[model samples]
Target: MKELTKQQSKVLACVEVYLNKTGFPPTRAEICKELGFKSPNAAEMHLRALEKKGYISIQSGSSRGISIVKSQQAFEKNVNQMPVIGLVAAGSPTLAEENIEKRIPCDPSMFSDSFDYFLKVKGLSMIDAGIHEDDLVAIKKTIDVKNGDLVVVRLEDEVTLKYFKKNNHNLELIPANKDFSTIEVDLREQEAFIEGKSVGLIRTH
Candidate 1:
């Protein structure tokens, strides 16, 4: 977990305890009351910091909307940096000038595999795999792929994230969520290519 400041640690502790006891995260007002803060804004600051540091996720438009994603530290800034790709335009390469949002400094050792770039996920097709829209999926560019690997692939004009499996000339792009169906492609007809494989993911700050 990211090292929290003394006050942030206290607020996080309070939230953990409250969530454990009540099955829900405490509201900003409740957090302030518990920590004896002068106002909710003070608590909000700490909460936002926690979220940014990848310790929690805050759902908008609701009170007590904090969800503990995990007690893990995010990538620390280092010499290595990578581009973050936004919504990919159809028929364009993944690394096209129009696709990249910006680059951020990151520690190369954060994930087991070194990543070339970060792609901003576009939908909930991989939600069951814990990858949601707007999340940055670490991508390692390569055409050499294996079955059952979470991958970012290009299907003609579209780039999508899915589990990959290839057999003969047929390829299956599987979705983790039940709401979506698996995409099957034939190498002989439809255009498809492996852009990269997902090495890891981090929420958008």
Candidate 2:
């Protein structure tokens, strides 16, 4: 797989999460919201980059034409033909499989170089991070992250996503919502685990 820049990787991960949750794809505005970008154009630029990098395929003028490439085997299975599902959102992961519309043909080569797995996004605590209610934030599993990186952290047995920041000798798990207070942990008090870093958002609605 090709190496992804920090920004590119984050956007891509968000996309995966949205897909797994809603079984659909996200719009550019939705992408901007989840990734903390000001303009949808930023999302569009990265998407184009994702397309150029062979991690995604975009159908111009269509909002639901985005698809991720899972494996080379699947890509080879259908050279120019693949499957397109219905519009997908990234908030809830517990939808009935029956809700899935028929699959349309697509190209897997579009997303051949991105990471694996999709995370279903829930809740709106991450709105400042652009993760709104029902947005699916795609994530790439990796233990590696620098201080202050936006991460999916399981704290106190609850799974929450936030930026990993440090203050003095304690670590700060900061939420995006102003209504929510930041979490401070003594390095010796307990352990904060990192599940993965976010890549992209797949908004369905």
State every prediction's TM-score relative to the real structure.
Answer: 0.58, 0.45
Clashing pairs counted in every model:
0, 31
Q: What are the runs in model 1 whose C-alpha is more than 4 Å off?
A: 1-79
lDDT of each: 0.80, 0.63
The candidate that achieves the highest lDDT relative to the unseen native structure: 1
Candidate 2 ranges beyond 4 A from true positions: 1-113, 167-169
Return the clash pairs for model 1, or none.
none
Worst 10 residues of 1 by lDDT: 70-79
Candidate 1, overall lDDT?
A: 0.80
lDDT for each residue of candidate 1 in 90-145, tens digit (9 for 90 to 100) = 75446644465765667645899988788888888999998889999988888878
lDDT, residue 92, candidate 2: 20
Winner by TM-score? 1
